[model samples]
Target: MKSFDVAIIGSGPSGASAAFELSKSGISTVIIEKETLPRYKTCGGGLVFRGLKMMPFDISSVVEKEFYAIDTYFSQKHPCITTRRKEPIVSMVMRDAFDNLIVEKARNNGVTLLQNHKVVDITFGETQTIHTTEGDVTAKFIIAADGALSPIAKIAGWKETRTIIPALEYEVEVPAADFERLSNDARFDIDAIPYGYGWCFPKKNHLSIGVAVVIKTNKKINLKEYYAAYLKRLGITEILKEEGHGFVIPVAPRTDFFVQKNVFLTGDSAGLADPLVAEGISNSILSGIQAAEAIIESQLDPEKAAVLYTEKLKTGILPEIEKAKVLSYHFYSKKSFRNIILMKYGQYAAEALTDLFMGERTYPKDYLKSITKKIKDAIFF
Candidate 1:
């Protein structure tokens, strides 16, 4: 049996990031992955600037493309809102290459990688004995960095508390003309679906186009219908090749404890994706860093690590997620109100969102009140 101080499940950004930080701190760490390296992960693959800024090492080799300007379209009545920055607002990457780079970096720092090992069960006590298809591995601490449908979280006794939203993405290779026309910038089209949005991210040779329903609904949403409409809207024709992938995004955090019995939940397992944009990469990486740091600061004491991790989240990532949740409610639920706010302050809102994506500013604490006061002042003046 292999043994380590920490064992991380899933080689996604979250797990690999935790291993990177833990190994760098001289802690014994092992990464357990179900799939082989360079495996395809279903994501829109658009890394916002905030996520890019969090990387400890250069990722130029994996970066497919970068965009300094982004456009957000509402409808014909409202003009498209564009935001520009000197630095790239978003960088494109295929997850297979991107994730493998992080795992390789961690391996260089003495982290063990056990690929093709799917965890089936975990026995918890002073330490955890993880049962995988290949063999058994034990660790003093376990970090669940698996994706939204985290079996580890379920095995650890967590009930469903997150708001999981549906999204469909396509890796499309259009004809030369179509690719040229759509490849210059990334864009978001609000109202492309009933209560959701559509995005187009240009990559090195293809386009990662996706549409997501950001809110929960009782009625059925035909995402395929919406995606077809979106493609027509974008003037795409004569596709040389295309592939479709469907996935869910957990926009809300778990209401229960983040740490249970020495097992730590990070990334999608903890439901830490951004509420407004449904961006998971930035928060996932951030939470993994915090988890590793918490364990390191606690000197591997499970109790202290749990308390410290919760405290760090409350002070840092959790608060920002709370603020973004409020903004998301208004942005999606209140259509008329949102339209009014956007019509009057569209440019300002776009710039502010850009700042948030760039890691330059956080969501305002009093976001609702702040916007209300601005609208009131505008009306009076």
Candidate 2:
């Protein structure tokens, strides 16, 4: 059995970031991943400015597209508002390429990378033992970055209250002639659907379109139907690919406690995803850094480590997630959303919402009010 200072489970952004930070701190860290390197992950492929800034290394090579404009529609109307940023606020990249880039950077920083290793069980004691497909390994601390459906958390006896929203996305090859019409202003569109919203993000050669809706009343809706309706609205008759990929985005609030004994939970495993936008990358990366900081601090004072970890998470990440819970409920509610749109905050709402999403501003009540006042001023004056 190999022994280390830290054992991080999963190689997504959270795991890689944690390992990178730990190794940079001169701690012996090993990152265990179930899949091979550069594995494909289903995502909307949107990375906001805040998330890009949190990366430990440069990611210019993997960026697929940069967006400066935002188009938001309440229902198809004459005055579909547009908001433009001076610089690109969002960049699109394939998940496989983005995640692999971080993992490679972690390895370069001296973190041992164990690929194709699935952690079957974890035993916590004075020293933690992680049993994996590769072999048994012991470490002083364990970090779980295994995502929303984390088996590690379950095995470790941590209860998670999950409110999962199902998302379906497809990549379509748009004909050259139709490119201009499909991407008029290089802005992504958010169509307010029945229970959720549909998004259209333009890529280099393809259009990434998707819909997300909450599962309600123990009922299952056909994701295919929702995706097809989005395409039909865009006047797309033929799809190059007949099928699309599906994934789950957790909209739940953060868990009660992020650390217990010798174990720490970061990223989706701790339900750090933004509730309003269903975005996880930014929070994942931020939480991963926080986890590493806690681990390093704990090495100095093991008695106060868990308390400090919880405090940092509460102050840094949980507050934003709490606000997102309220905002998500407001946006997801049909009546509230309609009232909000009627108030004319739709144009810059997405960008403002993205700002809050990236933890740049927690709860943009003031910004929303300013937007509402601006709209009122324009209408009267």
Candidate 3:
């Protein structure tokens, strides 16, 4: 059995980031990827400037476009709010190229990548056993960065609690003229789907369009139909491929468990994606870094590593997620509350959200307290 200091499942941003940090520290690491490298990843391909700033190395070659403003729309078309800043807010890149670039960097840092290796099963004991199509490999530590419906988490019985929601994305290769004509800088259409949002993110040559539905709302949704309606709203009559891909995204951080015995959950496995924007790549990279840091700090003690991970996670990603959950709750659950507030202060909220995306502002711990204070001081006073 092949053994290593650490084994990472899934070679996306989280796993690759972990490998990069661990290998840089001289800890042997292996990344097990089910598919060959550079395969198409189902994402809107919108990376906020914060994620771009967090990367240790440059990925300029993979960046397709950068936007200084993001246009956000309400259920109606006319009263849209545009979040603008002097610096670029979001950078767009195809996930295949972007993820491959990160993997290459991790490889350069001495991480071994086992491509086309599907993990069939995993067994936990003194050392963790990863059963793959290639062979069984053992590692002292396992980083389950394996996406929303993580098989590793299922095998390990980490937690049944997660705010897993359905999202669909389509990379439509429109004609060059239509692509140019229809592509906006960055746009998010709220209420594109009930209790969720639709987005139109421009790539270099194509446009990535998608809709997400919040599952906790208990609303039965047809994502494909919503996507078609969105295309119509955008006046997209011609498309090279109407094919769409569906995947699950975690909106809230897992409050249940981050570790089971020797396994550490990062990324979607840990449910660490941002609750507000549903952005995983940024926090996924952050979780990967903290996971490696915890392992290194704990001196490989599973219990101590678990403690360190939880503590760091609280200080790391949970606060933002909590605030986002507040936003989600108000926006989706309480119904008309979101509309009332957005109607009154949509521009301010849009600007704040843009700054939040750019890492300029952090969401207050108690969103209602802070925001209400601001509203009262400004309006009532």
Candidate 4:
């Protein structure tokens, strides 16, 4: 058995981020990836500025587009609102390239990279054994960053604790006219699908367009139908692909995503996507960092490590997720999202959201203070 200080499963944002940080900290870590590096990954491919700010190194080579404004629609084009900022709030990149950037960085930092390795089973104890097709690896700590529907998390008996929702996306090729026309702006349309939303993220040559919905939330509406309608709304008739790729995304961050037990869950495996936007890359990266910190601080004491990791989670990501949960139903209900969140505060809210994308503000960090002051001002002024 090959023994290491730490073992990470899956090489997406979370796993790669953890490996990168651990190596930088001089911790011995190895990442066991199920597939080869630079593989294609299904995503909206929008790297929010907040996510970008978390990167220690520059990825300008992978960035396809940087937009200064985000255009949102309630329905079709009616009541369309545009939020503009002084700087680009979101940058676009293909997942294959984006993930490769982080993974390569970790490799360069002295982290061992094992590709084409699928984890079949994991034996947990003081020393964890990860049995893979390639071989078995033993480590004092394990980080499960495999993604939603994570095999590692399920084998670890975490299947029932996390709830996953369905998400679908596409790399659509349209006519030159349409591609050029739509490429100028990025669009986020709410109610594009029942209990969900749709987006159009323009790339170098095509627009990655799709719709997503919370699983089991709306039984009557079909996501495919919504996706077709969304394309029609955008006048993208020349779809190069017949059927888009479909996957499950966790809608809310799991309260127990960080359950210690000498194993930690990061990224979608931990259900860390935003409840409102379903944006996850940023939080997952941050969780990866926090998990590394906890592991170093506890230094192989499983019981103590679990407690400290849980505490770190509660303060770091859990609070943001909790606040988002409260805001979810209300924000998505009866168009209250527009009335309460966007309208009540108006440009101020827009700026705040822009700040959110810029990593200037994080959920629940300044969430309570901002809301309390807004309420006071609404009543008295």
Number of the top TM-score candidate: 1
lDDT-superior candidate, 3 or 4? 3
User: Residue 381: error of model 1 in Å?
Assistant: 5.1
For 219-292, candidate 1 gives per-residue lDDT tens digits of: 79899999999999899857789999999999989988899978899999899999899999998999999999
Tens-digit lDDT track for model 3 on 21-70? Answer: 89878888999999998999899888898888889998889999988989
Runs of candidate 4 with Cα error greater than 4 angstroms are 76-78, 214-218, 241-243, 336-348, 364-381
Q: Candidate 4 lDDT (Cα, whole model)?
A: 0.80
Weakest 10 consecutive residues of candidate 3 by summed lDDT: 372-381
Candidate 4 per-residue C-alpha lDDT over 316-336 given as tens digits, one digit per residue, 9 for 90 to 100: 777777677666665565464
Better of 1 and 4 by lDDT: 1
**TM-scores vs. true structure, each candidate:** 0.98, 0.89, 0.95, 0.91
Task: Look at candidate 3 and tell me the lDDT of residue 124.
Answer: 81
* TM-score-better candidate, 2 vs 4: 4
Alpha-carbon local distance difference test for all models: 0.92, 0.76, 0.85, 0.80
What is the C-alpha local distance difference test score of candidate 2?
0.76
Summarize candidate 2's per-residue lDDT along 93-163 as a digit string, tens digits.
Answer: 88899888888888888898888899998888888899999899998888899987889888888876767
For candidate 1, the per-residue lDDT at 141 reads: 95
Candidate 1 C-alpha error for residue 363, in Å: 0.7
Report the poorest 10 consecutive residues by lDDT, candidate 2: 184-193
